[model samples]
Each structure stands twice: as structure tokens, then as C-alpha cells.
Target: MIAIVARSENGVIGKDGGLPWRCKGDLQFFKRTTMGRKIVVGRTTFEGLPPLKGREIFVLTRKPDAGFEGATAVSNPADVPADAIVCGGAAIYDLMIPQCDQLLVTTVKKEVEGDTFFNFQWLEGFEPEETIEETDEYSVVSYRRSGPSS
Candidate 1:
């Protein structure tokens, strides 16, 4: 599985249930990368999203019976497919990061206040495979797991 996220310099990924920064390039990059793929997200993240067209969405929630429209509800991380792209709201990332073989991260150039943060230490076992300076406001980095997979 691959984990994808956009975070500020201080690791802030969200503020008041949404992104802390407004970077159009990062938004475009996310859409281009995840389009037509299966995406796994936490319930809160799923709820905040606008209509996502052309992608299969799996919402990880304790209440799998809650019946989220237009998305499949999954209770366990094991229920998520190996090829699914894991998106976040922190907790989902924490749960799925261990299963991720790669990480696609967009780092917004500045730090901003947020209630949720991503731990960069999670990337410790991964190595940067590629990095693209998308714009002055942000850059995208791809990290692949180093060494052999267990």
C-alpha cells in the first residue's frame, strides 16, 4: 500500500478538519496521483471530502454499518487492499503506515497551526526515491521502503 499526504513544514496536516495551507499545485498533484485508483481514508477525512469522481473510496471506521454513501466502509486495516492509496486525518495514517510500501508526500513550504500532525519518523525505514519541486509553495517527495520487504 502507498500512503499519500500533504503536510506543513512542522508536520501539520490538518487544521479544524481541513488543510492548513492553500496550494493549488498540491491539490492538482494529489488529484493527478490518485485519480482512478482505490483510496483508503479515515471516516472523518471521508466526511470532509467533496464528491470524488473516478476513484474507489474505502472509509475506515469503527461504525462500518453507518452507511457512507458512494463509499465502502471498512472496519479493519486488513480489510483495505494492498494496492489502495491510504489518505489521512492522522489516525488512519498511524494505523496504515505500517502497511505502506511507499509514501507520496507533498510538503507545503511553511509551517501552520493545526490540531493534527504527521510523524516524519514514520519515514525512517523508507528512502527518497524521487522528489519534484512542484512550485515555490510546495514540493512532492516519493519514498520507497528500503531493503527487502518482510
Candidate 2:
């Protein structure tokens, strides 16, 4: 499975329930990587984005009914495909990182204000494989787990 996300240099992924910066290339990269794949996301994260058509969205929520149209609500990561793409808000990222075989991350060059953050230290578990300069403000990096599939 793969985990995809974009965060500021300071590791901020969200502010007031949305991305703190807008990078067009990162947006396009997200679309291309996740297209036609099953995407697992948290309820809050899913609520902020528009419905993705070609991808199946699985939302992790404690609520009995998320009421999100066109998406399935699941309580745990084990309920989805082992190969699903883990898209995020901070909590969901933390929950699913150990299950990820690969990580596709976009690093925004500047620090931005955010209430939610992910500890990028988890990236240490993966070996860096590729880095692409998607834009002047951000870069995309891919990493693969070296020893075992978590």
C-alpha cells in the first residue's frame, strides 16, 4: 500500500481543516497518483475535498454513519484493501503509516500555520527512491520500505 500527502517544511499538513498552501503541481501529482486507486482517508480529510471520480474512497470514522455520498465509511484500516492509498489528515496518517509499503510525499518549501501535523520521522522506515521537482515551491519524493512490509 502507498500513503500520499503534502506537508509544509515544518510538517504542517493542515490549517483550519484545509491545506495551508496551494501548489498546482502538487494538486496534479495527487490526481495522477491516486487515479483509479482505492484511497483511504479520515472523515475530516474526506469532508474537505471534492469527490474523486475514478478512485474509490474509504473514510475512517467512529461515527455509525458518515453520510458522505458515493463513499464507504470504514472503522479500521484492515477493512480496506491492503493496497489502498492512504490519503490523510494527521490522525489517519498515524494509523496507517505502519501499513504503507511506499510513500509519495510533496514537501512545500515554506513553513505554514496549521493545527494538524504528521511526524515525518516515520519516513525513516522507508528508503528514498525518487525525488522530482514538481514546482519551485514544492518537490515530490517517493520512498519504499526496505526490510519488511508493515
Candidate 3:
């Protein structure tokens, strides 16, 4: 039940520790999907997050104990919670994407100036199962990991 959640323009997700644009819709979507989920991310992404009160977080870093309250670091992605939400600073998502079961992406309509981008491709068996249309700014797409072929 793993999921990758992100918002981007032309596959680029961030710049200067902030999202390149403002889209309230996409922000809410990101919140809705991730709240209460077990979230796994890197140090930078964790620092970028707004205060999360009760959510469980696992951060990937060389410093296993280098994060705020309610977060612990495990060296690799395999040890994360089953229905983990991989939120990111790009590198975390890249390392964990292959084992991810679902992806929730918000594709911004405009190209952004950024230092990070999502480099993972939607695998062969994944289905573009859900899409939230052509908006004034971006589109929200959910890619689900489909089961074995018929």
C-alpha cells in the first residue's frame, strides 16, 4: 500500500525549500492523502514539512536519530511501514519508487525553476487509474500499481 505523493511542474518538485507555485487545490490534495499515513522521506523533505502532530514518520539519513519528535531514521526503505507514504526531496522517492505500490502526483501546468525533480517512471503495469482534470494551474493524477496481468 505504499504511495508517493508530490506536486510538480514538468516533473520538477521544488526550489529554495518551497514549491515553485501556489495551487490551493493541489496542496489540499497532498494533505488529504498524507495525513495519518506513515510517511517516509529524507532529511530535507522532513525539514520542509509543516508541523505534523500525530503522523508517524520515518526519515532516511545517515544520522538515524537526526530528526524532530515522532520521527526515527532507518538506513533503508525496506524497513518502513507497509502502507508507507514516500514524501520527498526527490532522492528518497527515487530510491523507494521501485517498491512503491501507488503514486499520487499533482502535475503543475507551468514549468518551474527548481533544484529537484522526479526522475522515476511509471512502471509498465501501473495504471493511470485516477486523474483530477485540467485545472487553471495543474492536474492531479493517481497512478495505482495494478496486480498481475490477465
Task: Please name the candidate that would achieve the greatest TM-score relative to the true structure.
Answer: 1
Candidate with more favorable, higher TM-score: 1 or 3: 1
Q: Rate the local accuracy (lDDT) of all candidates.
A: 0.88, 0.86, 0.73
What C-alpha lDDT, on a 0 to 100 scale, does residue 36 get in candidate 1?
A: 97
lDDT of 1 by residue, 43-139 (tens): 8898878889989999999998989898999998889988899999799988888788898999999989999998877787899999965678999
Error of 3 at 90 (Å): 1.2
Q: What's the ranking of the predictions by lDDT, best on top?
A: 1, 2, 3
Positional deviation of residue 19's Cα in model 1 after best superposition, in angstroms = 0.9
TM-score (C-alpha) between model 3 and the true structure: 0.84
Tens-digit lDDT track for model 3 on 1-150?
A: 555555565677887766777888777777777788788878887887777766788888877756566788887666887777878767776677667777777787778778877675644557888786567877877777787422
Worst 10 residues of 3 by lDDT: 1-10
- Assess candidate 3 and give its lDDT: 0.73
Report the lDDT tens digits of candidate 2 across residue range 45-110. Answer: 888987699999888889747687889899866897887899998888888888888988899989
Give lDDT for model 1: 0.88
Listed per model in order, the count of residue pairs whose N, CA or C atoms clash below 3 Å is 0, 0, 0
How many angstroms is residue 79 displaced in model 2 relative to the true structure, after the best TM-score fit? 0.5
Pick the winner on TM-score between candidates 2 and 3. 2
lDDT of 2: 0.86
Regions of model 3 farther than 4 Å from truth:
120-125, 146-150
